[model samples]
Every structure is written in structure tokens, then in C-alpha cells.
Target: MLIYPDERLAVFIDGANLYATARALEIEIDYKALRAHFAEQSRLVRTFYYTAILEDQEYSPLRPLIDWLDYNGFTLVTKPVKEFTDEHGRRKIKGNMDIEIAVDMLNIAENVDHIVLFSGDGDFRRLLEAVQRRGVRVTVVSSNSTQPSMIADELRRQADQFIDIVDLAPIIGRKGPRRQHHAHYDEREETTREFEDAED
Candidate 1:
């Protein structure tokens, strides 16, 4: 995280992207710790978390974590997944929150001196470039430590700084007693697996 105490800052979290990144690092981020880590670095004005939900089941798999984040200080941004059948008759859910993340970052660029982005999707390269044009410094957080780096080459190169998620373990990983893998959310769920083609 490229944070200086005096700088004004905000965080934009791409939910699915972050979950997978953290998993690749073999760590679970304590949300409260993650937020406090930034708060200590700057005057954190906002932390926006964006994700898509599949409504097929009566109860979505992510409801618990989603509810927790909303009740916390973080701003929860979500969109419903649209179901469609492709030409091959395979059902796919379409719900990408990239626009939401990009728009919020640009909207607040003037108010913030720094941005902490938690996803490595290459598509955000243009967004980062645009925000830089508006005079905001960007810190991209993802891992190159994975088998095939989670961050895009251009996005990582374009960022003012890139902080691999593994490096953040000591700063944000779980502390104290944890019971029965209580913190483990179902990583194999559909939405979580959708990133298999992240490079595709």
C-alpha cells in the first residue's frame, strides 16, 4: 500500500478478485484489520467493495460475508448476475463491477491523493491511466507470487506501486484463536471459480 499519513485516500475492492488473490497467498484478511491498516496510512474517506451476486439459489452463498461488510464501515456495492445461455447452451452469469469501481475512483480522484486498488484485472489499466491524468497516485494490490501472476503486466507496471498480497500477510492476516476453519468461506462456489479464465 502506497500510503503516507498526510495524504487523503480511498480504497476500491473488487470482491471476487480479492478473495482469489488472498487465497493464492494462503491467507485470510481480517476486514477490520485491512481497513485499519489504511486508516493508519491516510485519512481514509471511503472503501468501496464491489461484487456480483448469483440469485439462483434461495440463499446466495456469499450472504454472510456480504452482510458483515455492509454492517462494517466499508461501502458495499453489488449488482445482480444475469443468467444467459450461450450458443453452446452453457449457462453463464454476467455481472461485472469494473465500471462501478472505475467510476467511483474517477469521481473521487480530485478529493483523494491516493487510491488503493485490490484487484489485478488487466482491464483496469485504462482506468488507472485516466485517474493518474487527474493527478491521483495509484497503488495496486495483488500477487505476482501466484503460479501465473494475478495482476496484469500493464496494470502492475502502470501503477505508482504494486504490493503483492503475500507481502501483506503479516500486516493483515488473522490473529488470535480461530476455531474449526470458521473463517473459510466456500471458495469452490460458482462465482469464485469464474475467474479461471482471468487470463483468457
Candidate 2:
């Protein structure tokens, strides 16, 4: 939340991670409002959203949301999800965007004065450190409001500032009944589950 109006800022959103976090908190994020909130805080440069799509599906549940974000102010970076069977013969989907996010963040670090990362994955702790070393201030947006706490302790500690999504709910959360993209939310949850299972 500590932002200066003159600072150059960029937002990196891990789509699946954010969706899971918000769902855990029972909050629906208004993407427009979320963008506006950050734009108001600083010299917003860009917002990048990363996700993976199931290429083989006849009609992807996430297509609507993906299209919406693409038409919006967000930069979409996505790839096809790989479906494979595990050693135990269990089907799994692998679609982690961690590398893509890291590469983009590092590429933009020198140009931006600040970066706002929306993810709770502990894997990014070192990435935050690297950005900070380059004189870029990093703010992590996630939450500890859930029963198990969505934000990783080490990731929170690595950030120059940590803003809980719970606190941001009032400003960027949906006001009334959810929009038509409700189905996309369900798909995100399922994707998160599959991604985690694959990682395990």
C-alpha cells in the first residue's frame, strides 16, 4: 500500500493463484476496480496476467474470463496446459506460470520503480529478492485471512510491502451479484487443484 504517485509501477498477476486466494476468502474481484485502484496509486505502467489453458477442450470454461482480461488493460501471457498421467496412473495437469512470471518481472525490473505481485506461492521469494536488489520496491498482494493463510510466510517476508487481499476487498471486490464470468471462477479453482496435484 505504500506507493508514491511519481513511481513507475507494474502489476504481475498469477491468475490461478489469485483466483484460489480470492475464492478461499469468498471474495469476487472486480478486475476493472482493481486496475483503477493501482492506477490511482502510482504511475501504472502495465499489468500482466498469466494462466494456462486446456487446449483440447471443445469449450474452455476460462475462455470468457481470458477474453475479458485481454480486452481490458491487462497483458495476457498464457500457454497450453499439459495433460499427463502420473506414476500411479492418475491423470494430472501441469500448467505452472512461475518461470514466465519470473522472466517478465526480471525483464521489467530495471524499468519500473515498483512491482506489485499478486500471488502467494513461496517459489517467488528469491525472485522478489532479486528485484529488490535492482532498486525496485516489491509489494506482494495476498492474504492470511483464510483458515490456513493463503500468503506464504517467506514470500511475505521477502516483499518490501505486503498488502493482504482481504484489505483490498473493499476497494476492488464485486459489489453485488457476480457477473456472467462466474463459471470461469469455478474453472480456476479446478485448475488450481490440478496444478497443485501435479506439483506434488
User: Number of the top candidate by TM-score?
Assistant: 2
TM-score of each: 0.91, 0.97
Question: Model 2, which residues run further than 4 Å from truth?
Answer: none
Give the TM-score comparing model 1 with the true structure, all chains together.
0.91
After superposition, which runs of candidate 1 have C-alpha atoms over 4 Å from their true positions?
A: 176-184, 195-200
lDDT of each: 0.83, 0.92
Prediction 2 TM-score vs. true: 0.97
Among all candidates shown, the one with the greatest lDDT: 2
Alpha-carbon error at 180 in model 2, in Å? Answer: 0.8
lDDT of 1 by residue, 1-200 (tens): 55789999999999888888887777777888899899988999998989888766776667777787788899999988767676787766666788899888889999999999999999999999999998899999999999888999999999999998888888888777653332445544455665343224
